[model samples]
Target: MDLSVTGDPVLAQDETEVHAGIYLQKGTLTLTRKGKDFVAYHALVMFASANATPWAAQRVKFTATGPDSKAVEVTVDLLNDSWDGPRAGIAEAIWKVVALAATAAGDIGITYAPPGRT
Candidate 1:
């Protein structure tokens, strides 16, 4: 996504908060605190497993710095049997973080106004 905050000549330094809810067939995904200038953070918890596989709830948290930093943190809660399940959980976490960031950046773009343009 093109998440540039420089195009708007009148952007402010205040932090902005953005959130997104992602619904997948087998998982309840949520992305929050996206975009803005200082940081973007997200958390996801998978309550159930796919196809009765008995997976545990997975939690992931990430913080991105500035309007360009792609910093991310991920945490997963899984049963021993599912801990190494093809890295799907980690992948999902990463995806959610990016999605959250994009959503936030989009919001910034939509709400941005050059200091003297409006």
Candidate 2:
């Protein structure tokens, strides 16, 4: 469950979770799972201006495209230099953004034809 920039991080089978970040150096990161496929919805970046420090933000939305199509979103905020403690709102914001994006992608495809039908 721990993701490192140096070592290869793999997902656990029994676990349906994912983490996002950039690799400091060139390395191969493996995504392991018991019987599920991993899909990344989008990537986010937060950087500072020239006069300021650099900050990074990454968000990955995973949807199980197998027998069960369950959707879950994960967001990782990288603080430049100084490490900021984790915040609950961060995760919430991530999910909100993911949901909005998904909704905007297309219609729900639920049409009400009623008894008469069209």
* Candidates' C-alpha lDDT: 0.38, 0.32
Q: Model 1 has how many clashing residue pairs?
A: 2
- For candidate 1, the C-alpha RMSD (Å) to the true structure equals 18.4
Candidate 1 on 39-68: residue-level lDDT in tens?
334444333334434322333343334445
Q: Give each model a TM-score.
A: 0.22, 0.25
- TM-score for candidate 1, please give it: 0.22
**For model 2, where is the 10-residue window of minimal lDDT?**
108-117
Query: Candidate 2: global Cα-lDDT?
Result: 0.32
For model 1, the superposed segments whose C-alpha errors exceed 4 Å read 1-40, 49-55, 59-69, 82-118
